[model samples]
Target: MKEIFQQYTGFIMLFGLGFFMACKHEIPVQPAPENPSNNNPVDTGQPCDPNTVYFQRDVLPILLSNCTMSGCHNATDREDGVVLDNYANVMATADVRPGNAGGSDLFEVLVEDDKDKRMPYGRNSLTEAQIQIIQTWINQGARNEICGTSTCDTASVTYSAVIKPLVQNNCSGCHNNSLASGGYNFSTHAGLVVAVNNGRLVGAVSHAAGFVPMPQGGKLTDCQVSQIKKWVNFGALNN
Candidate 1:
């Protein structure tokens, strides 16, 4: 009987192995959750704050690039009877209420809409960061000051980073030294100041003392205009 048991041991071991294999469960693997930093390559370097929206730096550009189009919010067109061409308009009775991002038309149009109700109308929607910027700005009293001005070192934004290219692309082609339309050259800092001082750069570029609005067929965006204003206000810093 012992010899017979020994002979069958190998067969029993095989059977046991087969049973164990049959009872094992297969698990499906899942992909890892994306890290926002890893997922977005172009995210701004600084961490965003809900309390202090950089109004002059962050929010204004978004408004200029998206909402303020020539046929829409431009000073000349004022389509829909809404003129969002400058800071005053943005801070006025109809645009925003300081310290209340939730009540701002700027925020509502960007955040609370079906596409039809959105501010850029036919364009793509605003990014979460862009929306957050406006909301944070409103939450911060929506004043027209640089962030960190009264407190921390509100990061010094460079003219080259924002204003220079804007002038080059929008105004230089027509208003550069080579062209100097209406005796105005926006190609250099002095040129821009001269234009502004001579009363050829502000209002609508097309403000006819007979100077045509620039960039040929289009208006300088609200953001672009804002950049120029900021430069002028900042003593038109070089580089």
Candidate 2:
């Protein structure tokens, strides 16, 4: 019986040793999971051409469309004591600081998270391209410099090239299909012809008495006005 007990004890010890060895040697080591955050940093993506972000050419058009339309930030309304009609007024009221887009109040309101506090009020939000152009202009010192060094071509002005772009940039903001302030819609060629024939277009843009100064924010450049006048003299053809 003592010999049998000794044999049983030996068998149990061998089994225990084998189990311990199996646990230690048979387990496979797994690699640590990859960290997703480490893959790529947040990319806002380039909004506008960094080199072509000009205040007058790029930024001014956006402000005119979204900010200085009728009953908003125009000189007539001057809503909330803010007048974004001209570069001087915009610089003073919009709270823009040269070379600091993040710190500028104008840019802040544009990218505001709360819709109530955002700009363009009830109108459609500015596109990412538009917002970035403004931001880039602010970051690049927010100067009143115009884009393109080409000379103004007033002699051979055409509707498609000159008049269309001019009205679209300066007048179409409030006078577009969505807003149609003063019962005017300059979004289409036919719509523009109606304004041209009625003399309201020229009268308003020229800031004549009894007519609301158009663009409401700033006057058209002498060259621009002259070009439009020339186009009108040529019968305002839809060339």
Best by TM-score: 2
Candidate 2: tens digits of C-alpha lDDT, residues 141-187:
76655443456678799998889878876777677777888788988
Give TM per candidate.
0.42, 0.61
TM-score of 2: 0.61
> lDDT of each prediction vs. the true structure?
0.59, 0.75
Off by over 4 Å in 1: 1-51, 147-239
Q: Please give the range of 10 consecutive residues that has the lowest summed lDDT in model 2.
A: 32-41
Among all windows of ten consecutive residues in candidate 1, which has the lowest summed lDDT? 32-41
Rate residue 191 of model 1 by lDDT: 76
Total backbone clashes of model 1? 2
lDDT value, candidate 2, whole model: 0.75
What TM-score does candidate 1 reach?
0.42
